[model samples]
Target chain A: MQKGGELVERTETRLNPGYGRWTPFWFLAPAVFALLVIGIYPTISALVTSFRRYNITRPRDGFPFIGFENYINVLSDQTFWQSLGLTARFYVTVLPFQLFFGICIALLLHRPGLGMLRALARISLVVPLATTYAVVGLIGRLIFNRDFGVANQFLNAIGIGGMDWLGSPTGAFIAIAVMDIWQWTPFCALIFLAGLSMVPVEIEEAARLETSSKTALLRYVQLPYLLPGLTAMLILRSADILKLFDMVFVMTRGGPGAATDLVSIYIQRVGFRVFDMGMASAQAILLLIMTIVLSRLYIRLIYKEIE
Target chain B: MSTTLRRVLHGAGLIAVLCFTLFPFYWMVSSSFKDQSDLLASPPVWFFTPTFANYADIFADEKVFGSIVNSLIVATLTTALSVLLGAPAAYALARFEFRGKSDLWFWFISNRMISPIVLALPVYLLAVQLKMLDTYLVLVLIYLTFNLPIVVWICTDQFRSIPIELEQAARLDGADQFTIFRKIYVPLGLPGIAVSAIFSFIFSWNELLYALVLTRRSVQTAPVMATSFMSGYELPWGKIMATGTVIVLPVTIFALLVSRHMVRGLTMGATK
Candidate 1:
């Protein structure tokens, strides 16, 4: 008892509202330091590099500050506009399919009962999410192979003869879309499931009593709950789709004569392959602006506030 | 609709989703284990005597095997660094009312919106200037920056959910701030940390664009090895599949283990 009292006395003296004003800064300093060095610094450097003629091959001609020349070149180039349009098309193509199927599957999984099956289904969803993007491209290549692909085998079973999946412009575009949809649709479903879970049991039961039609009930009751998550998904997806590379790079490499050349791949070609650093940086900076602006638009228009 | 009919439809829907998600995985693993002829068979041989030759071939190749090691080192270190740096900042954000708090939060979260291509060239040049290209340190540092936002975002959510009374009690017991964080918040907040770690690991492991541009022969990652196959005239399906399976297996297992918290993690803790 004497020892405990002594310890309490020492503790009381020590507990003098110990935390100071700079405590949070001390905690945050390391991360903030690292971000400043690696994240913000590089971004500023990229912004600077975008305005100059910084081609690696032409070092004799020093990187002079040629304001807007690189931007003008990127903006005026027909190939850049085509690639940009294709990127937009890719986003438009995949979003609807993913959202539609995602919600449908989430609704199915959201149903009460089927305990074991529901658990198993959720586990299976992680496979696609976990698959490396490059591997997803390779998987696309193997599956879409004309001669020996499982895709053709299945199509043959269904009595549709195989066309060149990665050869023709239309086919390659579709193949990339299919791969993206396969990879991301599960993400949509998972997010929607989280949203659906928020629909209170009492509310769901009452709604079920009011209408036997699942569609009617979902339209009236659940979709409002889903809107926030749906908006989140849209913003994230828009950002991702705009910057997509790895998988398409592995699968097609902007292939069969620039058929599947999304903007990122094109920028990479200009930057690394063509060694035009300034032009590539300009294109990249523009792409970055587009992504930020698009997400901001989503937040302002669809997602007013998220708590 | 009858109860039985509704049940059957639900089962059908479940089957469709499973097939769409898992069929490619089955194909990849099955093809990886098949002999060359069976792998290239037209009616894509459903049944075959599995062989370890493809796996053996990949393991025997020095470059292929080396990249697997490189991926492991980079990803593991990146995960460790992200959690170590990000957790404390997250605790601060969760607990303290400080100046520029909202602005700081937005700044960190907005990092995710920056397209990698925007920074790719500049990062490549920075590495060149620093003479750090083709090294694991560069990759780890860059990945840490990318993964930090994820860790901070999730852990902040996790830390916020913990009761403030716990911290008050700890303080009453004379525990210091660091002690409260390390002892109380860290343990209670572990689920969030693990989820973020798993995500960080998977992302770094799977990352390609930065890995491709930054690392050359010496520190090339597993994804780079997988993509190098595309340059060859003859596509080796069996070996390619084996390499992919090896690369993806660990992270897939990690992801499945934490499926419960995945929704919260993926959505940056916006839901659940």
Candidate 2:
């Protein structure tokens, strides 16, 4: 038995190095345990809770199992559908503007001759990225205040003033979009700048020589290199927008007649304010399924790149 | 176009972008210092005499100071716990090729992608069951769901960049796996660790959804305190801005300190 154990240890050492068969396992055990407790446990519990009739207000009912009823209710609710639509609209509204301005700013910053100004601009970008989301919402409220907001002041400067930004549905939606774009465009720019940096210097110079047109060089040379980082940005940014709650929660509270009622806020209102756990958990599970699909695609792409 | 004209246009574009990005922060900080009259001016006072009155008001409110302390404690503990638990696991994944390693990596990274709203309800339920609601421990544990993944994701990349030959050399010197990691990997991977630590600190500091749900009064974070002002009938723009600026200052400083790693940290090492 001792000889066999020694032989097994030797083979394991050959496979790795100077480590026992269980060393990696021991090293990984703490994090795995933490993930199970902190990450997986709640998800599993949520899945279970989604199928029950659990409402905090109705404590005497005792959360009896009522499989599929909660899911059916959530699917059939008009507000749920409307909230999902608004979430999608919110994503659509901010993403393109962010991408366009982000790429444009990245191109400018990446230009070689800018020198000190480029460094300063990059530093400025970090400020927005660093600001807290809730604070951004507070800033949004101050910026879009009809009577005293800088936004109105600027609009007045350019001949379009006195817009009641957060008071009207259309205005509230646009205000949220503007705030989101302001906060995240810098993030997109930084990511695209990283992508641009990945483009080979030789390829860029050679492509420039072949076609003096900036568009041609960017289309043929830089776009391919940017695609992976762009994909990463899309996956992350999409996930964030899907779960966007804090800024809107603080700024509008899905207000002005639910004009900016993103799905998360809708769910929060149901789950916390209304104390409808089963319905909220069902909605959460559906959102979780969408996130799973998106993340799977992201994982597949990342693995392909790594391999 | 002439080269000079192109250069001039490029400079102008950069300046415009800078103004767009920094303008909010300027408004936030300047507004925090403005008295109500200046703050409520229709045209919005661009230049004015700064007042300490807003700062004084918020400072006098004990909740603001308490929340800031709570935020500091929760964020610091969360960062400490994530690094302590994540760095070793990262070292293992980076050094040893084991079965299910890729699966484990996928699981950890996917935790970040899971919307907090999904977890908030169940986590809240669990916290209530355990009688852990409104506690710092619950907040730290809930934060780990995201922050731990960040630590693992970034530190794995950091540990991977350390030369394998160094590990071999350490082993030959009679160092065990723990010793090698402790002596060689830890020192070599400090920058990555620092970046991850910064990311963890910033995220934990700024987190709102879970903090809002999980803690009520005892451990409400700075962001929650900042938002609590909104519940009043009349909005106090100056006091709110003061709270917002105080909450944002630490993170902005941290962000600038590691500006070089911003891209790498933000993308979770995908770009780097």
Candidate 3:
């Protein structure tokens, strides 16, 4: 016991700043450990497996050290190339349309409305975003079915021939794309709404005082402000679409002869369906590399998202 | 006259898009009620007497309630665990600077982007070895691949916003770091937790691939079971739609419930 105090608390007995400063790490220990196990371990294991041939049925055979053979075979495969091409098609087809429509809806919804109504509108828009892809895909398949679908019914009512959506290649692809855009555009719109709220009304008023045309104001001020949000949605959604699987899996199973298959579904087919883990690993590595490359470019182009 | 015409065009376009966006969902509900013959009619049915048979068959005969239970269990447990592990990590990253925090953050996010199917084989094998397949726990753990990072990322914002004085105040009061977190941070950051937890729950609930690979007969989730309805032409369209309506409607209701927090969570660090 010191002269001035009967007993001083051990923690309150301040050490050098460095001593207690690291205490947060102690608090952070469990989370970081778990993240490593759940996140890093399996990922590293996947990467390792990508290099080697893995067979679950013949586990006693062990994962042989196949080296670049898996990579080489995958590189030469026609289906892998086609799937990659389709994945690109999906990205090209969906991204711009979604961004444009999302922005438009956000603008319309930004008007003065009661909180409850606005909230209701927000909920209605967000609901599709939360629904699982499998459920959406299943419904999409039903809706796109030529004989039983409401979509074909709508088309038929207009004196147009009912299209066999899932039975054909292009029709099936478009149907899936449309389904995706439907589910995701609301997500983009919500992001846009978040972006819009960040716009300073004063800037618009100042632009108005300057007699800035609405188009000019939007072109210059609003669009510029929305870039970060748009960039984020772009990266996030692009990555998501590149890996589009469950929807396609449920909707078409990559069929009408592998028309709607994307990279992820291709990985699943090879790994699980065909039981070609080596080839599957190779294909997975290819997609992962491409995604990483694109993500890098995306980050470099729009790397201002530092928090 | 020209501006009015332009406004009219815009209005028409907006309404058209809204209806188009909503049509799939609308048709789903409608077709669920459509009779089989009417459903399969080449032109399809715009009007027919509504039928509860699909819902009846799905709930009563097909036994979809089990899948719903799976989805609920998976989503809820994953949310709980993600919060348990992710919150402290987020807090540490937000508040402290011992070492490697930036690297840790980047690593957490990179894991989020690695497509989940890549891990499916290994995880499947692991599940079999552990004999944990088709169970809620595997779904919860598999879900952490994305959900944990999400919790970590979302709470990073909230924890950053909390003034250090709160933590310091607790520390000065002889509270340990754990005590500080429980008493001070968890209470204040409950809203952020709620937002991310709802999202975490939704993510696991909606996740299909791991659930599909991990479960076969016993622990089928709604998403996995829903796929059975669309397998082939032999599927009864009305029954499929009814099941689809039941499966999706809850998620839609949930989305409405947490639209605000989800709005924030989806944006992550974009605005802030």
Candidate 4:
């Protein structure tokens, strides 16, 4: 056994240092190849496609390279700007509430003496995270159904009349945002819970000794320690929310007068619904640029905090 | 605040959180079993004889079952392929030193930051050109854009946690590098691998955008099928709820099974 093992090792190393040197490349090649095909190739294709008019409906037009025409058309489109504004609004509205409630619930669940309650909280938290976005949108539609929906029922029970959710512009937007908060707040909470767990007990104790006030303890000690976690949550959530498509698609289809037409929805509509691949590619490139830029800003801010 | 008052408030808060997190799910499951009339009953029917007619209705639809099969095939294949391709690269990054290693690692992880919309159009066009649209192979491949980064990131962390001393000791004992990796590191890093597998599975399973945009009638996944119930007038709430429950049930069960490792997987390279 020993001799056989030695032979294997000798053959692998002494006989083949060049093979040893290239092993990592071999391991990495499959993944790099896959990414090149799926990730990089598509990105490059998107860049090129953006410059050409390749309408599926008008294939005979011959996908000619139109230079900046697609970009100009996309930029000049009012709906594109509207969708951009809605996307921004959706992000701004949903993120703070997710963070606020997420942190609150995290703090609540993180409290030291709540054994069973904490377990229950943790289990329930995973349910939302486990749910698919499209399903969440379906559930949102059910609850917000104006005629006999549970939401309207609750409102009516409280003497506030039922309001049109998917039928009106503002209500549709708010409905989508609310649905997002419901689906994702638990994710934020769990992330914060993980972060809270990492906060050293000694630091908390030291802060408690310095101040008897809970708010001060939170403001001074817990929040600072949890900043990294908060930053991670923000980055993950913002990136996701910016590209959120499935929920809005299932719920409203960017309807009720395009009130909920997020940038992703707009792009899909242009590409698939309207068969405007060139314009959609141009818009998609812009969305990609926006995501990268925003994420970079976030990384810069967080790294500055860390330093 | 007094201790008793604080305790009461905490109790109330926990209950509220539970309801907030769980009510919609409960509603979905319950509505699945409710008759069409009970589904839309005013003030919501708190008590009723639960019926499985909606479940039967969805199951009877051949298209729904086909989509479910499609989802299982695509998600399972994507998960398996991602882990297979990703684990080695992760091991290499964790164990080997080479030029441009950090840059390469950053590039791999940053792939997660790319928006799916950016890939969607080009991929669709490519699929059209290649005549691979509505095929499981295309989806399994496209899903790599999301799943590969996750597998690499998590498994890299997992492989790193295994002490170098263990591998060196195995090497001194005349074990080849591949043998050491296969016999020692893999077993030792099984927990991380499990985390990566569970995450990749759940993500590919939950993914809707690619499945929706890429596939039409023959290859539609369960999520896409569920969305179809929305378009027609007089929506079938019962069937929709039933289908929603079907999509969520397996994932929720799997998530609970691996809930312990979830935070670690999700907060990869962030907190640590």
State each model's TM-score restricted to chain B: 0.95, 0.97, 0.91, 0.95
Score candidate 1 by TM-score against the native.
0.95
Candidate 1 lDDT:
0.88
Estimate the TM-score for candidate 2: 0.96
Model 4 lDDT per residue over B178-243, tens place = 787789878998888877888888988888889888999998999999998877677888999999
* Cα lDDT tens digits for candidate 3, B1-272: 58677566656555665575667788888888988887788667677899888787877763587888878887888889999989988888877665676667766766656687877766776777789987877777878888888899888888888876566556657888778888888989988877788788777878888888999877888888878766553787777778778877877777667777675566455554
TM-score against native, each model:
0.95, 0.96, 0.90, 0.94
- Candidate 4: tens digits of C-alpha lDDT, residues A203-236: 8888789899989888877777688777787787
TM-score for the A chain of candidate 4:
0.89
- Per-model i-RMS in Å? 2.0, 1.1, 2.8, 2.4
Q: Per-residue lDDT of A1-307 in model 3, one digit per residue for the tens? A: 3533323333334443322666777767787787677656766666777788786667788888888988888889888889888888898898888888898878766644344544455556876787778878887877787776767777877888688899999999999988988988888888888777778988767877886476787787788778878777878786787667888899889888988888898889888988777678667666677667755655555544453
Displacement of the residue B33 alpha carbon in candidate 4, Å: 0.8
TM-score rank, highest first? 2, 1, 4, 3
Error of 2 at A181 (Å): 0.5
Quality of model 4 by C-alpha lDDT: 0.85
Best by TM-score: 2
Model 4 CA deviation exceeding 4 Å by range: A1-19, A297-307
- Residue A107 Cα positional deviation in candidate 4, in Å, after optimal superposition: 1.2
DockQ winner, 2 or 4: 2
The residue pairs that clash in candidate 1, if any, are none
Find the 10 residues in a row with the least total lDDT in model 1 chain A: A298-307
The regions of model 2 sitting more than 4 angstroms off are A1-16
